[model samples]
Target: MKFQKPDFNPRIMPPKLKVLTLEVEKFDNNFAGVCYKNGRRYVIDGAIPGDVVKAAAVESFNNITYCGLLAVVKPSEKRVRPKCRYYDSCGGCDFMAVGLKDELAFKTDYVRRRLFPFGTEVRDAATEKGFRNKITLAFEKTNGKLNVGFIDDKTKKVTDVSECLMHEAVFSDLVKALRFWIEDNDVSIYVPRFGTGTLRFAVARYLDGQLLLTVVGTKSLPSTEDLYKKLKKRFPKVGLFENVNAEKTNEAVVGDVKHLYGEKFIESEMLGIKFRLGPDSFFQTNAAVCGKIYEDALEIVRGKNPSVVYDMYSGIGITSALFSRVAKKVVSVEIVKKAARAQKELLSENGISNVEVIEGDTEEALKNVAVEKGGVFFVDPPRRGLSGATEEILRFEPKAVLYLSCNPDTLVKDVEKFVAAGYKAVSATPYNMFRATTHVEIMVLLEKIENDE
Candidate 1:
């Protein structure tokens, strides 16, 4: 069965809104302000922690109220003004309205709360603006005209982006050029209902001083060469590409891709290891914070003194490449053939030969690969976490299993499963990969529970 992401476009009707005044006590896992009004728990957006705000109840389900911020009657001292102009509309940065100090404090408790009873250490990952290496803007209709930017969390409409603090300044300028080109050339934007348009999305990635731009539309535009020539004049090192996405699906970048100009791939250095990135590469947006997480994981690996390392579900083999520096041999199992081949090429480029790339599903590949008893298994799965791979890892019974998760909800559940299987979570650390937001990267180390003498 093919997998599909939920379509973001949904028709919204105006509903009767109820008003209430509440004092926000703290932040929930989603970074929304949680307040109690007359014994009813309300989750309010745009209201910071420790704030007295008036909100309109949007709806209620399961005895919990969901609302939108009406006004901040009394603002909290910890609430700092947003730095990004698009903070009010753009859903790209969820925590733009929050101060750095408070953001970290909430993330710390957020991770510790889920992994209770385990000693959790949340690192300081406060980063500045323009930390993202990639940007994807969708082309849609707004106010009877074409616009491009991120989707609004509430409205699900494209917000025109002229300046974004999350991405490089060049990307913002490129967005302006693309929007103008769409308006000047009179390009048709994709309409989900009618399902007709020339343009659908614009993807741009910056790596090592070069830009890889891609235009996603129903079909190739006639004026694509002209747009490329314009971008080339402004930015010398730029590559333009096209991704034809005709299906009405949630995926922004899909279909057959063709290189329009310049280089086809961009090389970026991550964690002191240089690797190539394409339009569809699963690269981390924040390089600095990603480096911090990898470095910490390597330090933990060193203390284990493993003879070999097993990297399961390794995407592009970034962790495998880094783990190869210390361990005698590292095996990376990846399902994607393209990423597996690229990992081989990347390892060869750096003259590292101890790492082996196995192209197959992690669960199936785990049966074929042989792991030593003193080795560590590192698994970085998707948001769904390990499905049936739990039994596979238990069968291997490595010295330790390192689970890196993007969703804490799944992490807690998986950790309990391991605990029941004779494993104890030794330590959990949260990395603020996406700063100014509740989304975090956590690494939990689980060691086998040996019978005491």
Candidate 2:
């Protein structure tokens, strides 16, 4: 999800400057505060709305200045004591310093600024603690000692947190276990420059009560059997696995996964429907906010009651499962080979027979599927919205199109194209999925506009 940057003028390039006192006006997407001084915008990290902060300029570009917050001369009323001890140091959360109420309000206004003239409304989430169901920790070596933690977005430094209140309560204990296991076993930490190490990353996912963990390394560890025993002792129901990512790149993405212990697919639920999720399954970390999006889509389905529903870019088929209940038949077009089968299995697990899974690109699959001219489209695309699929989807002449987007800019870009293709904008509602963060999940509705031909 894209955050608002410093509102800067492109033609006016500002030069580097020294330290100064600035009253922060508002927050950008990164939870940094923005303030204008002498017709220039300064973005100070860790500053908040209504704050009087002392800042030193790090760099300046085009009218926008990046600064570091030295001290808070006067704290804003919006500021509150952060719950996480590592909130000041850890790079996990974006808005931990601000109160939850104010954070939600800021996010609501942010959606308005992005999706103007669509009558947008933000469904503020009440999620604060235990909101996330997933966590990824980076493994680094500092001075020949194993360090496991989250990597800071700016400095690229990794710092471990004693407690992570985002996921299940057991995560805090789980991290300690990882530290002891990696350090005691003398595990080799992956170094990108030298390209010789084992431990690269640790990924944990929790659903309801079941937890799944995958310890990633450049190559399989000989001591993995010991790690599996430790996990089974702590989290009995935990699915233990080791992922091999032998690629020379520094990215933590897994290449091959091997299940070591426990359940392969954890049974998870969303809106009362149970679904099975594997280790590599893509799901929204914030479950409560995802429910809000699904509920709103259900409401739209109730209003339209179309005969056929086309779920374009359906990942894992969760939305398709929901659509199958309301529509007579649901056609899902998914591109990834593995994802296509996963969608079919997900629907089958829930006893859903109405959804026909088409394993191919949206444009090609649409040609073979028989659709009612009155069918509606449901799309929750990746950041690079629609790309070339928007025109193909509009060709169906669906009665309505409900789009869920994480990137506001792409959402607007795709919506504009739909409007040009004889669709009228109905409403755009943004959902705050992540707590204490500026990230937004938006859902926009468009209806076909009929005219005298």
Best by TM-score: 1
lDDT of 2 by residue, 201-283 (tens): 88888887778888888778768777767777777678888888888765666566788877787787887667777877788
Candidate 1 Cα deviation (angstroms), residue 315: 1.7
Stretches off by above 4 angstroms in model 1 are 1-15, 119-130
* TM-score for candidate 2, residues paired by index: 0.91
Task: Please give, for residues 1-453, the per-residue lDDT of candidate 1 as tens digits.
Answer: 322222221134245567788899987667778987677888886678889998777767665888777789998888888898887778777787777777777777777777775544444433434378888888778678667788887677788778777666787678767866777788888888788777888888886678888899888876887788778776878888998888878788885678987878887777778788877777778877777777888888888888899998888777898899889999888898878988988898777899989999888988887756768999898898988888888887888999989888888888888988988898877777887666888889999889889
lDDT of each: 0.79, 0.79
Candidate 2 — what's its lDDT? Answer: 0.79
* lDDT of residue 111 for candidate 1: 77
RMSD versus native structure for model 1: 3.6
